[model samples]
Target: MANTRPLVAQWSRLGNSSIAACKADIPRPALVSYQTVRHASGKPASKDKDKKKRKTRNTFRQYDLKHAMQFSLIDAMHYIRAFEVGQNPASAKYEMHIRLSTLKNGPVIRNRLRLPHPVKTDFRICVIAPPDSKAAADARAAGAALVGEDDIFEQVKNGVVDFERCICHTDSLQKLNKAGLGRFLGPKGLMPSAKTGTVVKDVGNAVKNMVGGSEYRERMGVIRMAVGQLGFTPDEMQRNITSFMDTLKKDIAQLSDRITKDIHEVVLSSTHGPGLTLNGEFKSANSIPPKELAGPL
Candidate 1:
């Protein structure tokens, strides 16, 4: 009772000084609105939204699972053969070209496929090894058109590389390298390398494989390989094409995690006919329109 009235008056007098000292020592932060703080920091409140928009623009278009096409192996063959059969001279042969989309760091894929129905061609193979070596004898026995080391080298040096495929033994590699034939063979894709299975220990097996194998190489993101000739039965052609596509799919599956898209489109055509794009989904052989052919056969 004695101090109550005076207590407020007494505290006010004491501290003007104490309160000012306390405030100075604490160093109070300035009161700023959220908008003012953001402006001062030079960062927009919508920065996250802006980033999201940019990310969406750069990403690949994601197709819905329902919209994905399911192509029929048999139906694709039917349409492809129909187009070829209608060709003027019936195209010397039918070729299958597959185009792919890949990421920057994707694997460089090349495969040698032996189709169920081989495409018959006039292409010949030559073997370079010691004339008396077993490899040379094996090569000769295996159907190599030409087999000799120095003789083959001479022919190659003199601009007489008539063969489409060249196989060499490990022993002759040094000689070939010394001859500086790389400048000649490299551009033609006839140079023998381990990767292409053109350099081998068993010349017989290599030559045999080369004779039957169809090389599918990825160049500029496209794979071009001969599926079968127009002379083949439709059933044979279908099996060949299906086998190739199945193998391709399996190989690509190994790299699926890093791939952007496995295949963009698969267009089938003969040597002379217009291409028919197989829309990832299969259609019945009877339902496919013959007029889907791009141009007059």
Candidate 2:
């Protein structure tokens, strides 16, 4: 009976030691702060810190990219003119090309701006009208390069197109096709289509205005147009560029929800110079961040 008592006591001690070891092996709850908890879980405690860091990185990238872009329209014009030191002034028109998001049959936008400083070039204009008609005489008075019916037809048929633009009386279109000028003029975008307001009864006015007008057209998701000449002053060039941007914005607004954001990038270049991207300062207020402008435009 005495031996049995000692054995029972030893067994109780063994059970107690086992319970103590089990308790020592178990983990206790950590008393960390909420922030530490969040960090441990692989999330940021405060989003602002991350955002600020991202912004700083973006600013650095923008600075790096500045060498490839101009700070403003005035700056771009200066660069373009500087690059034109030895080039012919006649071919020194400033061109702007905008990349846009992918669009399915996007709207064809055309705007005519009477630039603050008009491009001083001999803008050759051809008028397709009956030689005996008053419209033909008026076109000649408007300084049209060529004014004739069959003669103009023959010139176009012989691939002797010397005009920058073509103006036609609505009735004269049949004559143009009969001369087979479509294959020649269509490729040059000089075909007098009704959509471009080139096909009209007032051939004289059309010819005169087109001589001073710059046209913007969307081709394969890009808008390319001449903004001004290198001879224009900074203010004059800026005004012309602003007018074109305003017109473009209005046109995009009519078709989409975010007008300014729709334009992904704007690049300016002269006829003979390398392209310079415009800074984000020209972007609209709602423009997407550079990181988010990945897909289109």
Best by TM-score: 1
Write one digit per residue (lDDT tens) for candidate 2, span 33-86.
433554568864455868877732211111233355445554555556667777
Clashes per model (N, Cα, C within 3 A): 6, 2
Give the best candidate by lDDT: 1
Measured on C-alpha atoms, candidate 1 has an lDDT of 0.70
Report model 1's TM-score to 2 decimal places.
0.66
Task: Give the TM-score (vs. native) of candidate 2.
Answer: 0.64
User: Which digits, one per residue and each the tens of the lDDT, describe model 1 over residues 1-297?
Assistant: 332334345444655775755544542233223335545686544557577767433333334435544445445555555666655433467777787766434565677778887785445889889999989899989899989888888888899889988888988888877878888799998899887778888889988887777878777667888787665655565678789999888778765574654776676666766565566444465655434432333
Worst 10 residues of 1 by lDDT: 26-35
User: Any runs in candidate 1 off by more than 4 Å, and if so which?
Assistant: 1-91, 104-106, 254-261, 280-285, 288-297
Compute each candidate's TM-score over C-alphas.
0.66, 0.64
